[model samples]
Target: MRSLHPLVVTPETAEVVELPAGGAFTLLADANHTGGALGANRLRVGPGRDGAKPHYHGLSTELFYVVDGAMEFLLGDRVETVAAGGLVVVPPRLPHAFGAVSGTGADLLAVLTPGVERFGYFRRLARVQHGLEPFDGLRSEQDRYDVHFVDAERWSSLRGGR
Candidate 1:
């Protein structure tokens, strides 16, 4: 049974899950709502906040659109600074990570294609962020979420101790 209705997620109706990094992850249309076509969410980070550490999806491509402020992104071996109105698309298996540019807050919309039913992932992530659950608890679920964490030398050096 597939739902064919258009999905509408208003700000008030959307679920906002707070993260540990002075930020929040707003859950939007997920695979269940979109017939698995897309998974969407809003990621809002405070000044100098780190949104995600280096990781790559094994099955889903990711798209990020900076709606406000600036964001620093590590794509593969390069680090890019994208201002508001900027867009970055990452195909599956491409190492990537993001955070607010130093001293600035960042608001962005993130979408995953072939939606990965990731609401559970986001919720568990919040638990990890808030210390409700150890990161080790979430580590084993990465494969289920399609997110495979990996070390990126470039990202590590730049984000080290910061």
Candidate 2:
């Protein structure tokens, strides 16, 4: 059995990465910090910002807790609106995407179970968005991050191309 240890991450100790799309992710706790149990992050997005494109995790369940404002989610084949104080739990292999409402920004707490070290992935994403790297590079890392992107034209249609 593994020995128990306490992990504490204060705001000053946490690492924050700013994405090119006017959004940010603050790493709260990761697999290494939590004994491979889970990884957590705080996501903040500007109005109309896309938090994530349609994707599915092959080995981890993702959970989102809305802290403030509204979030529009495309879960599976349906589009749902999740408001502040709401929660959405996505099981592994379920297609999902999310964005802040057109007129309102959003703050969310996201958690992934049986965590995969993803800080590097997020950092690479930022680099791509900022033109420091090619987007194609991310394709090769899909399996490493456990995030597989998918087409979501139906979801876009549901949002009326918002």
Candidate 3:
């Protein structure tokens, strides 16, 4: 268990990773920092860009708050567009995905409860997007990262099979 205390990450000390898909991820806190209580990061999505593919966490609840522009999200079997200042929460085992709206960009903050050390997962995402590693390499790491990929026909259709 982690001690009950405060955790602060200054901008100059935070880790930022650029993605080939455009934009970047500013990591705030990982499981280790929070004693597995929470994980947080800010995502800056480029215009017409996808933030994450369809996936689910078996043991964590993920929350996303749109800070700017608009975002498209696939929750369970529905697809919806949320604007800035909107918040979406997904409980464990619910498949979801998100991205910036076409022709527009998005900025959002994401948090996971009972945090899993996800900074490494985000780092691997950048590597995969940059072609430094194959996507298949991640298949074996789903459990370690607490992210399990799933096929979402609705999401595929919405992204036009991108």
Candidate 4:
């Protein structure tokens, strides 16, 4: 069933998930909140922190809007730098990744369309990062989250080991 009324999330009411990789995510909405239409979250990463690895969604489009600082992204085979107020739209099956620059931090808004329940996925990632769970566990969950991890040697080479 879909919601007939609007849903609003304030900063104080947002759910915050701290990543073991040196950042935090403020979850604004998820599949349940949007009736599977979309999900939104704010990501804040410290300098030199990896936001995510190269991966592709099987069924959703990922849209990123940089709110502050700068973020370096691996969009398909290209490396691009998106600063504050910049936007990047990635279609399904297009491999991509992002992180804060070496000496600067970043703040961005990420939105996924055709929302899938991904809060659990993010939680699992935190567990993996904290050594509470093996990365193999996350590998098995890719299909469930629609996120398929991919090798990013090209991106690493371009970033000079970023």
| Model 3 misplaced stretches (Cα beyond 4 Å) | none
lDDT of each residue in 1-162, candidate 4, tens digit only: 565769999989998888755678888888899888898889988887778888999999999999999999999999899999999999999999998988888999999998989988877777776788997888888998999999999877755664
Model 1 stretches with alpha carbons more than 4 Å out: 1-3
Model 3: lDDT of residue 133? 95
* CA RMSD of all predictions: 1.4, 1.8, 1.0, 1.6
**Per-residue lDDT tens digits of candidate 3, residues 1-162?**
774889989999999999765689999999999888989999999887889999999999999999999999999999989999999999999999999999998999999998998898999998988889998888899999999999998898898855
lDDT of 2 by residue, 1-162 (tens): 221898888999999999755688898987777777888999998888778878999999999999999999999988889999999999999999998988898999999998888888888877876789997898899999898999899777755554
Candidate of highest lDDT: 3
Residue 54 error for model 4, in Å? 0.6
Using TM-score, give the best candidate's number: 3
Candidate that beats the other on TM-score, 1 or 3, i.e. the better one: 3
Give lDDT per model, in order.
0.89, 0.87, 0.92, 0.88
- In model 3, state the lDDT of residue 80: 89
Q: Which pairs of residues have clashing backbones in candidate 4?
A: none
Task: Give per-model TM-scores.
Answer: 0.94, 0.92, 0.97, 0.92
Tens digits of per-residue lDDT for model 1, 68-155: 9999999988999999999999999999999898899999999999898899999998888788989788779988899888888887
Model 4 residue 2 distance off true place after TM-score fit, in angstroms:
4.4
Task: Supply the global lDDT for candidate 2.
Answer: 0.87
